[model samples]
Target: MTVILLRHGVSTSNVAHTLAGRSAGIDLTDRGREQAQALVQRLGSLPIEHIVCSPLLRCQRTVAPLADKLGIDVEPDERLLEVDYGDWTGRPLGELISEPLWKVVQRHASAAVFPGGEGLAQVQFRVVSALREHDAALARKHGGEVLWVACTHGDIIKSVIADAYGMHLDLFQRIVVEPASISVVRYTPTAPFVWRVNDTGSDLSTLAPPRDPAARSGPVPGGETGNTVSTDNEGVEHPDSHTE
Candidate 1:
């Protein structure tokens, strides 16, 4: 089974460095829409049989173009929802420290929970369960010819990948998930293998930048991570009130 995790394109929260925190209804920006188009064109060449979308606007928007290309509707699932950030909603990392359980959450994700939110163990339960079930369904449906796309947020995607591969959160925190990027994993009918990580729309094989001396390379340089949609995290909440 082959599973490709994709972070949604740019959104309002990305530009402000604030927590979206399971806030529903955020929409994709113009550039984000374009990024989705790029994903369609790039991955269009691959034999994609199914798409899993979070019940959020950014994810739906991100997968819409790809669904058009595949001639299939996105399969929505509530388990893919982002973490509920509770009191930290709309606040940036700096201000988020003021939240009640921020310290515990930052240290031991498994033990942390927002005021009115979920714990890391709970988040992992749903996300991981969703993934396994999706794998089973896709395997039965497509056999070997399957490319499943999951439109999800930064933290959730990171946590799913990290937990699946047994990576430490420290490394997970450093890994970035840019807008409309493609992170790939493949399990050969038995075990899972993460073949690639956070590849942006700009990294599309067909549209990837030329290997020139000036080509922007190596982790996309810090401070340049912000926009309307993007981030480097795992086990985080979704943004609120998206539209697009």
Candidate 2:
């Protein structure tokens, strides 16, 4: 199965270079809406069976277009919410960069906690757990492989990438998830494979038309540690073939 991660479109605060965090009332700019619509064109061909999104208004708005087009109701998952910037919420990014905590966030995120909110480690744990649990259930429910979209924030997406790479939490900052970008991950029973990261544009048709079950020799259903199916010698393109 594949989990495609999408960062929310640019919000009003994004243009102002401010950290919107959990702030209320921040909606996507007109360009953001355009980007959301463009996303529909980018992924319209894929057989997306499930959609998940963060509770934040920006993420909700970002996924609205695709969900409507696919006739799929987006399930709001709080675990995908933007990092709670706490007192730093609504502050300009330029200003926050001067703060001491900013350095900690960049160099030692696992040890950095929001002044009055959650820690990066905590965010990573819940978000990754939510994704794993949801992925397994969706694969089973759909019978065999599945394709799903997760509309979330940049930091949240980066955290998941870091986890899949088995990198320490502090190193997550090295990964970049641009607004309106798409990243992908495929989990077999053995290990997780990152197919793409922060891809803003590309043809996604390569993912279409599910593979024939008779051709695959790997584990049947899906689980965290399912056996890896090797399709190399047969020249078969894995649905989760695209990678970073």
lDDT scores for all predictions? 0.67, 0.79
lDDT of 2 by residue, 143-181 (tens): 778889999988889899999988999898888777788
* Candidate 2, residue 225: how far the Cα is off, in Å: 19
TM-score, per-candidate, Cα-based: 0.77, 0.86
Query: How many steric clashes does model 1 contain?
Result: 19
RMSD (Cα, Å) of candidate 1?
A: 9.2
Q: Which candidate gets the maximum lDDT versus the true structure? A: 2
Which stretches of candidate 1 lie above 4 Å from their native place?
168-171, 201-244
Indicate the residue-level lDDT of 241 in model 2.
7
| Candidate 1 local lDDT, 1-244, one digit each (tens) | 6678888888766756677767776677677777788777767766677789888888888889889988988999888887777666766766766666766665666777777777767777788789888988877876433567888887788777776577765345545556676786654444565646776533333222223422222223563311222323343333322111
